[model samples]
Every structure is written in C-alpha cells, then in structure tokens.
Target: MYLLELYQNNYSKDLVLFETLEEGREFVAQIPGYTLETEDGFDVEYVNPKYLPDYMEIVFNGNIVPLSRFSFNSEENVDIIWKEISNLSVKNDKVIEGYSKIDAYVVNNDEVKAYVEAREANYRKAKDFIERCGYEADRSFFGSEDGEAILYRKCGAEDWHFLCHLDPLFVEIEDVEEYVKEALEEAF
Candidate 1:
C-alpha cells in the first residue's frame, strides 16, 4: 500500500492511500498543486497498527469534539458515530485552546458529570486510606507535582515511604450518539 499526502498552500489538505505507485501517480496527474514522492523502505505491511493514533477529530451536530476536557471510551461505537460526525463540515480555521470551552457534542452530560464526581470521590477515598493506615500523605513530596501519585510516610517518621498511585474509578461513556446542550455548558 502507498500513502499520498496532499498539501495546499503549504498546509495539509488530505491523505489518500493507494495500492501501487502507478495508481498514486494517476491521482497526482489528475490533481494540481501536488507532487508525488515515493519513500524508500516504506512498506505499508511493516507498519505497526498499535502505534497509530487511537482517536480522530470529527464534527457532529454543528460541533467539533469529543472534547479533550474529558476522557472516555476510546471506541465509543465508532462506526455509527463516524457516520454522524462525517456528515457535518469541519472548520479548518477554528483554533482550539487548551481546555477552553468550545462548541461540543455531548454524548452524555450525566455520565461526564458522574465521572468527574467519581474522580473527586476517589481522591477523598485515597486520602482516607492514608489516614486510616496512620500514614501522612503529601502530593508535593518527592518532587511529585500532580496528585495522581501521592507521597506517603508513616506519621512522624523521618523518611518518606512509598508513592501511592491510586487507580480512580470513572464512568465510561459507551457511545457518542446523544447531544446534551447543558453538559458542555456546565463543564465550562
């Protein structure tokens, strides 16, 4: 297999796959502003599927998302969801800021809310565990910045003991199908 990238005005426009170099050349002949270049040792079958990106950006219900603000199921009924998302047009010029509120299609506002709530509850539970075990936990200890890996030591003990990386329980949305206007609204 062959992978051909099409760029317009120095920006990536599209990517097309071909079975042979001849077929790829044929496509290049029909289109303008594209150059065909074959890469040496670029065997399609040699590529590892696991290294490929797991997610895709798609538009649905006038919103481009599966908002990165929250994490959910990777698959999420992709075939059906893609059909819906593909129907909508994507705005190439729109800029997405880091975790900022943007137009989004909410699969389930309730699930998103529940996931956040559950994560918070899990943090509290983790703290409780340390206290019950007579251990003092500090997130800033041992150069740990995020609370995900908590540093704990026996109460009044000099040396810091082990790092507690708790696995928090979270609600996973099964599919991307519904649109909840209030979900994304409340998240922001």
Candidate 2:
C-alpha cells in the first residue's frame, strides 16, 4: 500500500507522521479522543494531545467539539476504531495530479500498406507546430503495421510521449478527434 504524508507541522506534525501501516495505528492511538462506540461501528478522531488529562476533544458533525463525557463498551470497539482511522489516514495522502489518454488507430486493410502518407502527415504537422513554438521535434515509433503509423510530439524539450493509436480503417474518425483533444489536455 502507498502512504502519503499530508501535513508536517512542528508541534505535533513530526510525531503524527505515518509512512507505514504500523505507524498509522500508532498515530491514531496517540490522538486524544480516538475510540470506537460500537462493535461494528468504527469512529475515531484526532485531537490535540496537549489538551488531554483535563478534557477530550471529540470530532463529530464535521466539527472538533469538546467531549464533556464519553465511554467505550468494549475493547474490540477501540481496535476497530483505530483500524478504520489508520486506513483513512493513508488514503488522505494520495493526490492525483492529472490523467492522460492514448488514442489507438488500426488499419482497415489486412494487406500491409506502408503508412507513409499518415506518418508524413503527422510528422509534418507535429514538426511545424514544434518549430513554430520554438521547440525541438522528438521522433519515436509509437506503433506500426504493414500500412499503419503512430507517432507523437511534445512541446519544447519535453518528452515526446505517444498519446494515441490511429487506425484509419477500423477506428471511427470522431473518436480519434476526441482522443487528440484529450491527449493535448493531458500533455499540458
């Protein structure tokens, strides 16, 4: 499993770091109001440790409300609660920056028809765009068949990553258009 560290502040930040499953459990237990109310229910909250001994801060209703009084019915509840909190803490760290789509195209004919025209067309267009934008054109084999071609380009000195596959005969033209748009969005 992958763990992401969200906030690392001075006072309680370093002590609250969780990079592994074990660390996550330890961190959850350290929280002042961490507990489970029922056998099946797993509810836990992170509270300032400094305020402990005198008062407990319960996290409920999306607010860190003070717990005037609270009690646990069973030890199993405490275990379940910590387990749930550990899982949530790990999930909160994963951040998705963006996503990219790859467009694929297949040729209509079974016979190998050199994709000279398509390759030249894409290369020309990509080259011109790159040159105009003051960027270098990177070349690479995306995929090739007897008569099909696939190539890609990135702006500037960036990597020339393949964004899609183009099959003139099998793939619909409309899908190819959408794929191109999505690829550009992902690239940027």
The residue pairs in collision within model 2 are 103-164, 103-165, 104-165, 105-165, 105-166, 105-167, 106-167, 113-147
Clash pairs detected, candidate 1: none
lDDT of each: 0.37, 0.40
Model 2 vs truth, CA RMSD: 17.1
Q: Using Cα atoms with residue i matched to residue i, what is each candidate's TM-score against the true structure?
A: 0.30, 0.25
For all predictions, the C-alpha RMSD in Å is 18.4, 17.1
What is the overall TM-score of model 2 with all chains considered together? 0.25
Model 1: worst 10 consecutive residues (lDDT sum): 78-87
Off by over 4 Å in 1: 1-111, 140-147, 166-188
Model 2, range 19-104, lDDT digits (tens) per residue?
A: 45565555455455454243357433334333344545644334453432223222122222121123444445543322222223
